[model samples]
Target chain A: MYTTWWPPITLSHSRRDQLLRALLWSCASVAGLMLVCIVAFLILESAPALSHPGWRRFFTDAAWHPTEDAYALWPMLAGTLLSTGGAVLLAAPLGIGTAVFCQWYAPAWLAVPCRRLIELLAGIPSVVFGFWGLVALVPLINQWQPPGASLLAGICILTMMILPTTSLLAQASLAQADPDALRAAAALGFGRWGTLRRVVLPSCAAGLLTAGLLAASRALGETMAVLMVCGNVVQLPSSLFDPVRTLTANMALEIPYAAGRHRSVLFVSGLLLLLLVISLVGSATWVRRALRHV
Target chain B: MNAGRAWIPLLLVLAATAGCGDSPDARQPLTKLSITGSSTMAPLIAAIGKRFERRHPGVRIDVQTGGSSRGVADTRSGLAHIGMVSRALRALEQRDLVGTPVARDGIGLIVHNTNPVGALTPRQVVALYTGGMTTWRPVSGKDASVVVVNKAEGRATLELFLKYFHLTNAEIRADVIIGDNEQGIKFVAGNPHAIGYVSNGAAEYALRHEVPIKRLPLTTASAPPAAGHPAPSPLARPLTLVTTRRPPALAQAFIAFAASSHVHDLVAAHYFVPLAA
Candidate 1:
């Protein structure tokens, strides 16, 4: 509160706040600009395609047929949800466990190396993972299933890719848990796992959720590896081994040669992706608000 | 005198280097026609653009190869002045969209040179891709799996190969994967148990495996033959220059020029068959 504590500037006290506010405003505007640009392009591009009953069929129907133009999103949506859900299912437990290991159980000597390996795996390019999965992982998976590159292959890849971020965040959150609470729980004769579950994990729930959201975004926008491994068949996915495609992969694959309404349909697909992401964001915001109220 | 003489030689070398860097007026920067599409059409489009620029100074043509499907889509969305595709126009292709044939490219199945199985019937290739033949045992007289390599999904090659062969829902064995054309070639060359198909232009005939891995013959498409294009139709499709609307004047000029007989010979020399009648 003292004058010496003030930021250095030859201006009135209000100037600093004004500059800070302007900087924040500009940063926010830049991000908003990207969203606006995508929306504008999507609306304009999809206008032609959306005019037809085919658009409704595409959005509502479960089937997709390029030969007959019976485009549909239900099957694709199901595939997307399944792959992403499977990824989350695998990643959540491992991520939390790894975080727990890093935050509490793992020897200090092993922590950095373990984290680094996870990071390196995640940092490897998606295309590299695609090649590796195709060359190495899928073949292994095929030992059980006759053919590989199934939804399961994609999920495994996504899990491996998402692990580093999820674990890192969970680690940070768990690390930030109140020491006093853990000490009290220990004093009360609670076991280490008991304290971790009852107290530490509850406190870190917020960060864990954040990690989940980050992984979700990765699963959604993921194009190359999933495209390579997901068998790209358009029927409703029946099992984890079923071949599938994601919205982004479809756009990447189809956008090149599509014309007129078909091109617009791809953009519409993009718009659908945008809406899906926004809905997730909305839910995340709602969760945060509810958490704050609690 | 020696200093002056040395300067003259250096200047001459510099002049030659600069001259060779780009033709002073060749491939001029004019209407900025940006074309992107199939890697198969890349060389052909680049050849056409180079000739187009040489003829029309001050016009720039930017041609990109992102693969054919994207090219066609880009043209539809007006993102490209032209799109080049290796495959024919699908039923889903825009009604207003039209294409002029640049050349006919022969597609051939490629295998590891070490693969002793010299050639496959089109039926056999179809069977292999549709997951009918999973092992190299019968073909090579060895007990090993046949790694079937395919283009990425939604690729023009997948469509062309499938449609031509009358196969459906063909999946690349998750176990056998190649990232791109080059990788697929290398994978086949190195693996000794892999098979794939590539356009003749994109197919490396001079690679170490080229001689060993022979091009599998494709049966002719059922068609009424016009005079210029012969029977046994070379298993070729028309490589097209796709634009959303007719390209700007300079690009159109180049397109017209590409359709000319002079460049037509150049296309054939590059091993692309002349466009279908």
Candidate 2:
């Protein structure tokens, strides 16, 4: 008995499936809509500054004097890049090394504790880390140098913060490399070193790169710890010792007090940061895709 | 069976959305008066609140500390019954609120006790903050980079300092951007060459407590009143109580209690200058 007609009163199996699909679609759409609304709102709010005469000057000029209408973002933009880049540079090697050690070198009993330790490190709140950096690391730096809160201190703190993400992800990806390949390499009169280099390392290169990019993104978005350590100076950092202010730190420190044109300028800088992050993630995905094709 | 099973998920979705709604109020017996804003005014307000609560047994006074702007915003939004502000209302902010001067405070520059800087001419102070002079040699005769510590934006002390110096916040090249008076004092206290400004009351309290920080006086007598107060030395600003509308009877009583001459000892105890009799 094939009843092809639709059930109007009762929910048929297909109709129920359709309803569930629609509900899931609505949930997903809500998330997507939130992101769209945020981007649209930021752009709309920032349009006045974007359309101003000094708008182009924002990218070119280095002096960020909002009261005098000099709305430059070079220093902060550079600071964000330098700090994130420094963190990635320090964390990547350490993270990859730890990942490699855990995957291939560590004994069976040691591996679980090592991974657990890294996860615990990740679980610690950022403010706690910032406090430690303030009470512990700042004085340590001060003992070595005069002005303790500087770019180096920021880099060091951010490096510690991002390490768990980089290493954990890299470790997961490294685990996916074919165990058979290692066995095959061993069978071919290759040493353990040779097996890791030729068989294991090449297979996980893209994953390692992805981990680095993800860690970099995390470092880029960090606010409190960097704000606490970076000293919030609005200057082009000439050396690692010089204090610098990031876009996030600037927003956190100034947005409370900003009004009028100053307010517009801060919103525009936020838009700029949003764009920078999008481009960073975009490029990372593009690279990952390109690497997959290769 | 199918309809009943389907209702479970639908009911869950509804429940999740509806779960956050408030439970019906249990009758609150206490007459609550919320006071928020101005960390500078927090201790004074807290002390006064205690005595007020003792006098009126059923009344509760809630004191909170954020910046002065939070006070203004909270009062405007009706989130707070009264706001404590440490600076005079700007011309634009004067609308829609009534301000009562409760106490006086002065903005003073603090330096490490190791630094021998006694007083700065208004010109020298401006020059130092603007990064025109980097070393302490001109101000205190130390061969080190002058670590100019400035306040984060929107603080009353920062606003007063900027106005007094005839400088915008951006013009100053600060090595550190501290959040509050205590933080500014701490930064200056820790570093040998650091100079930062905070409320005179806070600095005085810290100094008296043997904190290794000293308040610097402004040497320019007859410096314009627009800069701060014409007090001839310390830059004086008022700590105010603000309300968006005529407060409720209880709130008005609290206001009168806070403003009366009886609180003079309380004001002086908190290290703020008592209002002239």
Candidate 3:
């Protein structure tokens, strides 16, 4: 009797399976389509700027006075790159070091709390971080250096904002390390630090690089914290103490009052930012693949 | 399980129907009055709107801020019943829109309280901003370098400042460019050698809170106040509410309410100077 009931049930199950597969495929395509639409919209909106005043002015102009038609984007672009690069250079080592210590060296009682705190830090809003930076960090720096809101303040705030991201990803990568390899290193009479250096680190180099790339991307797109602390001067910073404005910060500050060509130029900035992020993600993927062969 | 699965679609249909029926027009005809523009006046108008709502039931007033241009544009397009313009309307705008003056706000220069400089002439102020004079010693203050803090482009304060001083944006050698009046105040308050300008009303309110900044009196060489009379502000502009040339009855009522003596207390509480009766 059970055998006779099977054919109809199997037929119905296959029908449901086909329906689910079609639904999921459509959902994925919709997401991809939405991304395409956004790119198209940005290009369309920025076309007026690209044609008038031309792209040359964007690269060569001295300052970023959009209302006056001086659209030099180099200073803000440099500000964004320098701040993001400086933040990643400082944050990556600290985050990875914390992850390594918690995984291997920290006692159980300490490690649990440390992990929980990192998780908690990740959940805090970026605006709250910006406010705290403005209230606490800017004044402290002002004591040592006049005009405390500068590129250095922006980098410090960004490093704090992205630490949890790098740390959590590094911890995840460390967990995937082969337990057999660790024991083998111990059997070879290698010290704990030596084992980590020779075996554990080499094994997860790709994952660690991925973790760093993700954190860099996050810092690149951060607006509020950098805007609040970075003094927003449309000039290239000569020193760490000098104030600078990033591309994202410039867009946020001016987009509300922007009109006509000014508004289109802001969209151009958005398009440039999108391209940078894509290239970053592409390079990360390529590096991960290259590291696998080694 | 089949019965439960069947109810899901039914429940979704019921939810969709309920959402559609909950639209304001279907439930009741609510007359919503939309007001837009000028971040400076948004707070004041919002407070007045709350009081108006309490008095007139079934009337709604929506207030939004996106700078004065948006206010002007929105009123012309009929997107808003009234637009809050922080400055007086130009002749071009006055042709299509009628402006009702509600209060007065003046743009004034501010510096940290510790600075010895008490007053700056219009010429001296222009020189400091244009990078002609870079040190405080030139302005009779400390020997330290002067940090010029300027408002970003498109701000009404920046526009008024530039127009009054006859200086273009490119001429300003700003060490730091800040957005909004609060940021400008905060930056000046933090840096002892920095000079920035913001709304007089906003600066006065900050002073009440003991923010370590002082507003300098703006004196022009061309016209000095008569003896026994206080010096009038050279940077003052009217805070006006703009409407179409022929406004609806409801908009007219609200405009009258806004400009009347009844709301003078509300205007003064926000630190704005109430218009003379």
DockQ of each candidate relative to the true complex: 0.16, 0.36, 0.50
Which residue segments of model 1 deviate by more than 4 Å? A1-20, A47-51, A54-56, A59-62, A189-191, A288-294, B1-35, B47-61, B67-102, B110-197, B205-215, B219-233, B241-277
**Highest-TM-score candidate:** 3
The residue pairs in collision within model 2 are none
Per-residue C-alpha lDDT of model 3 across residues A1-294, encoded as one tens digit per residue: 245652333455555665666577899999999999999999999899999888898999988889887999889999999999999999999999999999989999999999999999999999989988877888788778867889999999999999999999999999898999999999999998999999999999999999999899999999988988898988889899999999899888887777789989999998888888899999889988999899
Q: What is the interface RMSD of each candidate, in Å?
A: 8.9, 3.0, 2.7
Lowest lDDT 10-mer window, candidate 3 chain B? B21-30
Candidate 2 deviant stretches above 4 angstroms: A1-33, A139-146, B1-31, B57-66, B77-79, B113-124, B138-141, B204-233
TM-score of chain A of 1: 0.88
lDDT of 1 by residue, A1-294 (tens): 456643455456465566575677889999999989989989888887788645668767645655446678767777777888889889989998998887778898998888888778777898888777766776565555634657888898888888887888788778888889988999999998899889888777777887787777778778888876775656566777666777877777666656556677788888888887888767766765676455
Q: In candidate 3, which residue pairs clash?
A: none
Give Cα-based local distance difference scores for all models: 0.70, 0.81, 0.87
Per prediction, the TM-score for chain B is 0.74, 0.83, 0.83
Model 1 residue A207 CA deviation in Å = 2.6
Model 1 RMSD, rounded to 1 decimal: 10.1
Q: Lowest summed lDDT over 10 consecutive residues: which window, candidate 2 chain B?
A: B21-30
